[model samples]
Target: MLKKIDQAALFLEKNQQVFRCPFCHEAMKAKDKTLFCSNRHRFDLSKKGTLYFLKQHVKTEYDQKMFQHRRALILNGMYDPLIALLAEKCQGERVLDVGCGEGSFLHLLEQQATLLPSVGFDLSKEGVYLASDYNQKHFFCVADLTNLPFNKGTFSTILNIFSPSNYQEFARVSQSNGQVIKVVPRSGYLKELRQAFFPEDLAKQHYSNEAVIAKFQETFPKMERKIVTYTFEIPENCQHSLLEMSPLEWSVTKERKEFLQKNLLSRITIDLEVLIGRFSADNMKNM
Candidate 1:
């Protein structure tokens, strides 16, 4: 079997055409484990096996521990339904997961479907580290969504799963006949956790997607939103991971977090809207 580094290096080499220099915004190619541009701006793959393609390194609360738990939750099949739906909706084999934390969803989808050139990018190096160091079956790099380092019209499909994205960038990088699938959380997504964190705050307990929907409709003339609401059963051992992985827990008091950790909740809601976007022919050229 190829070593993880070799595998990762090869993957990067195969798709280097899509990568561009963060400094000069020019095409980049892999050169002995380093990505180089015509301008000589370079980026070396780290020991963790991820290339930092962002203009500047970013720091976020998304750390290794959170990715670990998120990985476990995905493995436990908590999001299998969502995965199945994504697999069905995904149009092309060349898929890019923006904000792909820990490589769980992309890796799993690759298994479910014969997706070639499955690539994952995240702004958080910690998340990319967890993904790269753990497995090298696919591409995982530290890249910001706002300033994606990709050639124009590269990907046939772009996936933004509960992550920040620049719609204009998505339109620019995606092929003329491409699909943009974005998963945004609905009001009841992790309802129990929301209640646990802010039990008394009625406004905090509820969520809405009206504005988000309007924006998606505005961005993609041909768009569809599918509401995915289901209750998932997470084993006792894995419940703690769910708590640790979610940003919703960030605001919770330490006491509440600790309390919820001990008294595990076996079932949780997985409410989200999967928005599928396809740009119109008229807007494609302008975009």
Candidate 2:
């Protein structure tokens, strides 16, 4: 079997047309385990077959451990319904997962549908690094959403799952006829944890995706929305991971964390809105 780096090189060589230099916006070619642009810019793939597109390191609020917990929670089927919905909506020719943390969504999406060329990128190197280990077939990269390192009209589906979005860049990189699927949280999402962590604060206990949904609809006027809401029973071993997986607990007081750490919730609320649509022809024209 080929090493991870070799696999990535082979994939890039065949599909180099999808990529663009982040700095110069020039087309790039893959050779010698590196990507080279016409402007003499080069990006070398890491030993693990991951690429780093950021010029400087970014400090994310979550660390490698948090991502590990997130992956564990996902593997335990916390978001299986959401994943299934996403799989159903994805066109899957050349899919790009923007802000794909740990690459679990992309990996599972491919498993559900026929395998296709897939790429996932995140601003956190830790997250992207963990993502690379999820599947050798998928390309994982540390990249900025605002300055995606891909040519225009490259992907058939763009996934923005519970992550930040750059609609303009998303529209720019997507095929004119392609679809963009975005998942945003609903008010009842993680309400159990929120109620536990922020009992005194009502605002923090509830979420509102109205602003996010409005923005997504504004960008893709023809979008369709699906609400996936359910209660996932937390397994004994996954309790801690579920608690630690989200950023909701980041700012909680030490006493509360310690208490919750000891008394984990029995179930979690998975409330999300999955929006699917195409970037209008006018949007593409503007791009």
Write candidate 1's Cα lDDT for 143-213 as tens digits.
Answer: 87778888888888989898876888888888887888999999889898788878878888998977887
| Candidate 1 ranges with C-alpha deviation above 4 Å | 133-135
Per-model TM values vs. the true structure: 0.95, 0.97
Off by over 4 Å in 2: none
Show the colliding residue pairs in model 2. none
Listing every candidate in turn, what is its Cα RMSD in Å to the true structure after a full C-alpha superposition?
A: 1.6, 1.2
**lDDT tens digits, residues 1-287, model 2?**
78888988988998889899999999999999999899999999998888998888889986899999999888888888888877777744678988888888888788787657889998888888888776677798999988999999888898888888888898889887888888888889888999999999998997687988898888878889898999999989999887788888788999999998888898988888889888778867765
